[model samples]
Target: AQSVAQPEDQVNVAEGNPLTVKCTYSVSGNPYLFWYVQYPNRGLQFLLKYITGDNLVKGSYGFEAEFNKSQTSFHLKKPSALVSDSALYFCAVRDVVGYSTLTFGKGTMLLVSP
Candidate 1:
């Protein structure tokens, strides 16, 4: 079984300030991590993924995530946040092997103020 957790319910950031959204995971085996963003009345949009190789995975819209095996964490980061970047962020995980299903976190709301 695999699961993901987003500790913060909401993340508030200024228009140009750097932002981070924390995520942690637990799985029986190796994990495939992913991040998605959702806008109001819109579907989830793919942000980035961390499967293998680099620990730092870059994604769309200047967003990136750092995969830390030792810490079992995959935190999302952006150098400069925009007001348009405000949305619901989700973290998901699935086992690399076997019949594991993708599990998503409760989601963290990012509020960027102009």
Candidate 2:
């Protein structure tokens, strides 16, 4: 089985500050990790993915995530926060060595205050 955990239910940041959303996962083998953001009443938008390569992966809208194999963690980061970035974020994981569907965390609502 594969699962993801987002310890924080919400992350608040002031505009122009950095932001982070934590995530951890458990999988049978090497994992495929992903981060997505969903605006109110909108579908999930792919943020970034960690398949294989440098542990640090960058993606859309100034978002990046680090894949730490030993810790089984993939935490999302943004250098600077923006009000528009406020949304629901999700961390997902899938087992690379096995046939399985992706499992997503409950979600983390990021509130960027102006």
Candidate 3:
């Protein structure tokens, strides 16, 4: 299978604190990376993606991910998180597909408390 891993099962942060969700991956060809955030009872919302260009990819909701080709890592980062930012975050890689099928990790729950 296409290789991908999220090391953290969950992350907790106080309100207005910075937060990060770690991710690592591997693929045969050039990789396309994506990050998604999921709220309860809602579908995965596309946060961002690393398509064919720059290493630092910015996304919605003040989120950004840095794609490291050498390390095979794409870590999600946000400065000064809010309580509303708490959700399940997923890091994905584009596996063999025409529609960019995302191979997701088990997910890391971000608990932001005030």
Candidate 4:
């Protein structure tokens, strides 16, 4: 089984300040990690993914995540945040080896203040 957790229900940041949204996962086998963002009345948008090769993965809208294998964590980050960046962020995971279904976290709301 594969599962993900977004420990923070909400994250608050000021515009132009750095931001982070934490996520952790568990899987029976090697994991394929992903991050997605959903805006108000919109669908999920792919932020980034970690299949293999790199520990640091970059994504759309200046977002990035670090894959920590030992800790089983993938925390999303941005050097500077924007008011438009305020949205619901999700962490997802799937087992790399089998017919594992993708699982997502409840979601973390990112609120950026100007």
Model 4: lDDT of residue 42: 95
Best by lDDT: 1
**Candidate 2's C-alpha lDDT?**
0.96
Kindly list the per-residue Cα lDDT of model 1 for residues 11-111, writing each as its tens digit: 99999999999999999888999999999999999999999999999999999999999999999999999999999999999998888777999999999
- The weakest ten consecutive residues by lDDT in model 4 span 94-103
List the pairs of residues colliding in candidate 2.
none
- What candidate 3 gets wrong by more than 4 Å, as runs, is 95-100
The residue-by-residue lDDT of candidate 2 on 15-97, one tens digit each, is 99999999999998899999999999999999999999899999999999999999999999999999999999999998988
> RMSD, each candidate, Å?
0.7, 0.6, 1.8, 0.6
List ranges where model 4 is wrong by over 4 Å: none
Model 4: lDDT of residue 45: 96
TM-score of 1: 0.98
Candidate 2 backbone clash number: 0
User: TM-score for model 2?
Assistant: 0.98
lDDT of 4 by residue, 1-114 (tens): 788999999999999999999999999889999999999999999999999998999999899999999999999999999999999999999999868778999999999999
